[model samples]
Target: MREAPPNAVAAHYATCTALAFSAVAVPFLPEAVLLYAGIQYLRGFLYGSRQWRAPARVPLTLGRRGYRDATTRKRGEATWPVGTADGRQVWLLRQDLAQGCAFQGDDPDWQAASIERLVFAACLNRMGAVVVQDHAAPPLAGRIAAVARPFGCDLGMAAIDLHASLTPPLHLTTSAIEAALGDLGLSEKAQELNRALSPVLRMIGTRHGLNALALYRAFLDAEALSTLSRGEYEIDGLTVNTDGPASADAAALVDLQALGEAEREEARQELAPYARELACTTGLSLTDGLDLGTAIAARRLTCIRPASPLTAVLVQALCCEALAAQEPVSGSEVLVHLGELHALSADTVRRFLTSTTAAGAIGTVALPSTPDATLMRLVSESCRIRFEHRSTGKQWHTHLISTLKDCTFSRDIEPFLVERSGKTGNI
Candidate 1:
């Protein structure tokens, strides 16, 4: 007979010694036996010669005590075991078992189903049934399950779950607002002006249901009207003479303010065309055919606020792009892709990912196989970020709202009025 290899002999002796120790310790130290058995089983499942297989059955008992594995019963509740392919069992749970019988015989669908069941069961055991159920099948569910398998679940789920229940709107402090404004390339004077205006803007928001973008648009309109009131203003390198035809048309709108309410309503309709022409010609930014004052009067101006730095839509897009790729994506590659697509800088992207404000909407996993280099994959689909007060330990959550396509800005601002012939249109 062929002699067993040296490694096999060592393993055999190790198993025998463990079994002898377990036999002697069972009576006085039953817990030690169980622990040793579990450790050995996990070792076999992960690194032993036999392949890991699942959906194995064991008898279950539900007597006066509670549910447990029954030693002698031939028939029992279906229990799935995390074990080696050759039948060494690691872990089993009665309450969380898969809802199918053991692998009775070989069938392709059954085999596939068994693998799926194992994946689902493992994820459910780790992340709870809700997370497992939330992800869709084919790719997302499979990918999430694969992620959960090694780490035994996203450790961040507890914080995420806690925050989801009590999420609140983002409330930027004066300092936070200043920092965000600075990031947008605002001058120090501009930042101070915005800071001074924020309280009033926030009040306006509360009363009118206007968001940050709408408030910014209102400020811009006011600024533009003030410039037009001067009869001349320089923007960029161009000197705009509001005293020209565009200004005359806009000044006509000021006259409507003095008329009686009923008369003003009638005059607005008659004057709207002239206002539209003036807006098309003289407005600094593109206008929807109404000058700032006329738009304010008609309630036709609409502006959507830009998304916050860590919006869910942005994070989701990043994750989807990375996961859908045929090959693994590096951390730097992800940042570059996001920056190019969304006009975000690398520092901004990094800040969002690492910020405690992000709650735990996203997480990263390092690829172990790539020893020479590092690779990462995102691991969650949650849509909330968090904020915590350092002194009070009080927490606030911000649900990452979906962004609108039309509201998104992908390019630099364009001049509303372009000169045709020697004169600008409507001027």
Candidate 2:
């Protein structure tokens, strides 16, 4: 057996310790770290009000490529083999619930993190579900899952199951989930945590392709609209129609079409906020402009998906590329900004930037009369990349759209911002 490296071992210990203590103290979505198909397990516990236990170590099996693997008893706490009502079994792995951390150079620890994600994908394969519950957002989760696809698994969507397997399993409607969330004793505590992190989420929205501020404003707007319209209103799904005619290959309509009525309703309650807000503020209906923008954003993200370690660098760089004609800022400035956002070490950020710059994924310009002053810019607004099969010499070209011309947020997040700004004096 190959012994784990010292750094990997240390990181494992630190992560497990943090998760164990935190799960015990704060029982908010303790199973949220699960990659896919674990949402039902979470719903079961949360709705059933059962006493939840943080499994010490999940049983794992590493077998030959085609052999049936048997579970090996590992170190730490005993693993739990919790069977879902659908007859699928998932072991509560180690106490660590986090998927992966930010890049820390080309170290054994980073490899270990990648290994964990691979294991997660494998587990999802066995459990047989493609939806993931990612607080980070669907696009990012989709990207990471795409990276792990080579491990014989593919993640489909980012969502949570609204029902748990019980006797005559309860399928929750949108209002039901909302009500349950409102009354959960953990909501206040979770809110406190989210409150602390909201600013950070907003600051990196542009660079990360998430647009947190816009999403939040949309959510708030949906809530108000839902209330005012007495739950009769709906945000129709539309294709993105920007920068000339929308491509048929543009992402399919952003709809909950794949889900059952209850599932779709619940998901709509969660995601439609962002989409509807996008529509209202832009004066674009779901069928006209908003969907097109979503398609564009989704299309841009395709290029970001296949690149790892380079993911953040590419995401930030693409945003910069779209927002300006010339190098809006020096490569060093962008590097520093990314470093602060991701909390990466100077060395790791520098190396990532250096490698990508050399590969021409990122472009730089020299300032006049300034020695060694090269400002970073995007390579192009859009371009095509070719990937060739090594053995067959078969080649395919993929068109990559590096920028979204309509990546705009709500004006001051509109009505929500106005109230929060205290410009109204008092209620």
Candidate 3:
């Protein structure tokens, strides 16, 4: 059998020591406190340390009467109550209850936060239902959905099951959301939120037969694209400039298909060593493990636009040729092939390749001593691949517009676009 990594061994030893200390201290400490600490430690070990940290405490009081006048009020299926504090009622939804706390009062900031959480929960619950129905895995769906919940709320199966049973169900319609927010006196911010959230709502509602992973990816993509449309032009280091004229810098067209395959292969190779250990511990298949690992790893890969059009075309064509050949192609071989096809000079092609490689549009095994060394195509899967100078900006704008259309919230994110048009900036 293979030996465990040093970090893994150290982690195991620390966990065992902690548990032994807890057991020894149980006789002297309060049972409730010990239980809570144990639960928190287990949560940190299982999920992550980041998720285990406690949120800020917001004090709840009931006017002069303090806790005496506070009473639990039920609205629909919300597990938490609306508390009376200083003559103002603080509303708590099921989402707040899931996090073990609620905002202190009806301040605009608190209201806004509440509204955002409500909308997110409604959308996530709807997505979870869709996944459960489409995948025909009702038993596993609740657990999976609970794991996928946002805001570091690791809810139990019971809370998820309660959400699943909400009456009339959660709808993504504009009026429904507005009406919900209106109750909290936040109808004024409805239009602003509609712009921010429409793309994700529309993508979820219109697309059919999306699995859990696909739905999650769509959510992330739509959110990122929506932010871009609003003139917030930085997403994982990729620049968005949908309204500008093409710059003189060369553009690089990423081959998403090739990149996705490469990423999957890399994920599989990384997971292969611990396959048996993971199976015994988590009861997950290799495919399921790969899906989870890929989702996490993909966030680290950055995709940027190339500065040269010639470099962009060269990289795009080289990637296509490499994919077809199912192996890395030599720089000299590609130079000859592209020269014959595009009537390009050898020196120009070589220069473009060097520039493209430097920009990380392509990869190389090593610096070629001779012209026979292989060139590799590499890029991020999330990148858009448009080669034409005239249509690149238009394509981005069109893509965002299409995704934002037919959403249940606002019709378009034009306000952000109009505001962004007046500014002069790059990235």
lDDT of 2 by residue, 107-187 (tens): 222222222333333334332222111112222333334433544433332222112111111111222222222322224
- Candidate 3 local lDDT, residue 219: 29
What are the models' TM-scores? 0.26, 0.19, 0.15
For model 2, give the 10-residue run with minimal summed lDDT.
409-418
Q: Which stretches of candidate 2 lie over 4 Å from their true place?
A: 1-125, 128-138, 155-427
Model 1 bad stretches (over 4 Å): 1-7, 10-181, 208-212, 222-342, 356-427
Candidate 2 is scored at a TM of: 0.19
Best of the candidates, lDDT:
1
Q: What is the lDDT of residue 52 in candidate 1?
A: 20
Give per-residue lDDT, candidate 1, residue 147: 38
lDDT of 3 by residue, 177-295 (tens): 23323322333333333323333333333433223222223323434434433433342355634345422111211111123333433433432222222222221111122121121
lDDT of each: 0.30, 0.27, 0.26
lDDT of 3 at 164: 30
